[model samples]
Target: MEALLIAIKARILELAPEFLQFPLGHLLSITPVISVFAGIFALTTWIERKGLGRIQNRLGPNRVGPVGILQPVADGLKMIFKEDVVPRSADKIVHFLAPILLVIPTMLAFSVIPYGNRLVPIDLDAGILFFFAIGGSAELIVFMAGWSSRNKYAMLGAMRAIAQMISYEVPLILSSIVVIMMAGSLSLVDIVAVQTGGFWNWHVATPWGFVGFLLFLTAALAESNRSPFDIPEAESEIIAGHMTEYSGFKYALFFLAEYLGLFAMTGLAITLFLGGFHAPFPFLNWVPAPLWFFGKFAILVALFIWIRGTLPRLRMDQLMGLAWKFMIPMSLITFAAGATWHYAGKGLLAWILCTPMLLGSYVYLGTALTKGQKVSKRVYRFAD
Candidate 1:
């Protein structure tokens, strides 16, 4: 599937005039990314609302379209027509620029992700590094939105974003570094190539890879502000956090940027740990590679939605505590284990050495962190 797309793209580039070819080549590469992910973004919004409604035992958005499949279209139109409300005290320029800046970085992060064989938009040598560097700008954009709003809730959200980014970004990078080390390249394509044989060769099949994958997903949840880690947008507490003062189209941009970030993070996770676009088994290799990529992507998105429905939001203190007290230490241990696995020649000896250290650290950390907290037995009271 991806090969055909790649061939068509090459044909277009070959047919273009010299000066236009360079720009057209890039346009061909990036246009599909933008279109596909933007489509996914729309589909995710509908799926989330419907999925959440099901979890909460109700039908959601059925009035909009058939099973509300066209609900995202309705949302886009609503945002377009809604009043553009802005605070009188807000910094006009920064307020206008914040959402735009946020979306740019989020979109750029996808450029390095390997969608399928030879399907990366921008395959830099330091592809993973490029992804992270572009993604990091989102923190600054969040702060800009909050500060420019001149709203206390927004400012608080921005502050929380800073703290949250600091705490989680460390562990996120550390977890990914294990993959980079194991694969022996910063190029995401190279990393994917290393795990090409079968599911067993995938990073997540190994001890350190499994631990690293878990840590990566946990930090990704925090990074993308999903569910329990969604302190910045705790609607019950602060009413949309940094987006408190935004309205209409600008507000919609922030919403779109967020889901884009989530998709980008999920793509990176697939690239690093789930074997990218590779089929799970040699016999399955005949299947279109893009199908495998998007299939895994869909499963991860559903997992995120399930988690959002199941977990309660963490308190600010608890969120910070988890990042620093548990995630960071575990990520460090996982990194060391990856190194051990490499030096031990990636055999039973490596598994024998690395697995115990990881399991022990996990148990000790869980026990240690909860030590000072008071635990009371659940007392169920029936409603009259």
Candidate 2:
């Protein structure tokens, strides 16, 4: 199957016109990636809504195409026709440019992600650093949207978003560093190459890797402004937060950037910890490489959606505390554990040595963080 794919790609390259061959070929290659993610972004909205609906015991978006599959289509049309509203007092230029800035960086991060064995768009030696460097700009973009709007709520939301991002960003990068240390390469493809063989070889299967994966997932959710960590746009409190002044397609662009960012981060997680496009088991190698990649990607996306349905947003103080007081320290410990495991020869002896340390730190810190916090049990009252 791999050979066939290579042959087909070579044939297509041969068919290209001589003069425009290289540039046009590159453009053609990237077109499908952009289109696929754009479509995925649209579909995700419907999927998330439906998933959340099921969780909450409600039917979601059933009026469009069967199962409301066309809801995103309808949404796009509505946004296109809707009036674009700009606050008269706003900085028109920056207000206009903020979404574009936000989206471009998110899209650029996609270029470094290895979708399959030979499917990377631009494989840099420092791909992991490049990914995070581009991703870090999102906080600035959020600030731009808020500051340009000149609305207090928007500005406040931007401040909160920045603080949250800064806090989570530390652990996010630290957790991934553990993987880089294990793989001994910053290139994402190299990272995956080291993990090949089967599911057990994947970093997430190790004790430290497992802890790092959990920390990475937590930091990812916070960084992306996803639910339970979505305090930035808490509709009940901030009325769309940094997006309060945006309307019509401008609003839709913000939504697009957000979901695209989510997809990119999830894809990175798949690459870093879930073994990229590698099949889970030896027999599963019969599955196409890209299928293996997207299957894992989809499951992670579904997990994010499930989390949104199950958890309530954290209070601002709690959110910041989780990152600084708990996740950072835990990620640092995981990093140390990874180094120890590596030097100890990656044997059962290594596991025996490291598992207790990792588990003990997690329990100690987790208990310390949650100590004295009251768990409220709800009591239902009925009036007859």
Q: What TM-score, over all chains together, does every model reach?
A: 0.97, 0.96
Candidate 1 lDDT over 17-79, as tens digits, reads 999998999999888899999999999999999999999999878878788899999999999
lDDT of 2 by residue, 206-248 (tens): 9888999989998999888999899999999999989999999
**Model 1 residue 18 distance off true place after TM-score fit, in angstroms:** 0.6
On the 0 to 100 scale, the lDDT of residue 236 in model 2 is 92
Each prediction's number of clashing residue pairs:
0, 0
In model 1, what are the clashing residue pairs, if there are any?
A: none
lDDT of 1: 0.94
Judging by lDDT against the true structure, name the best candidate.
1
Worst 10 residues of 1 by lDDT: 375-384
Off by over 4 Å in 2: 1-9, 15-19, 377-384
Candidate 2, residue 130: Cα displacement in angstroms equals 0.6
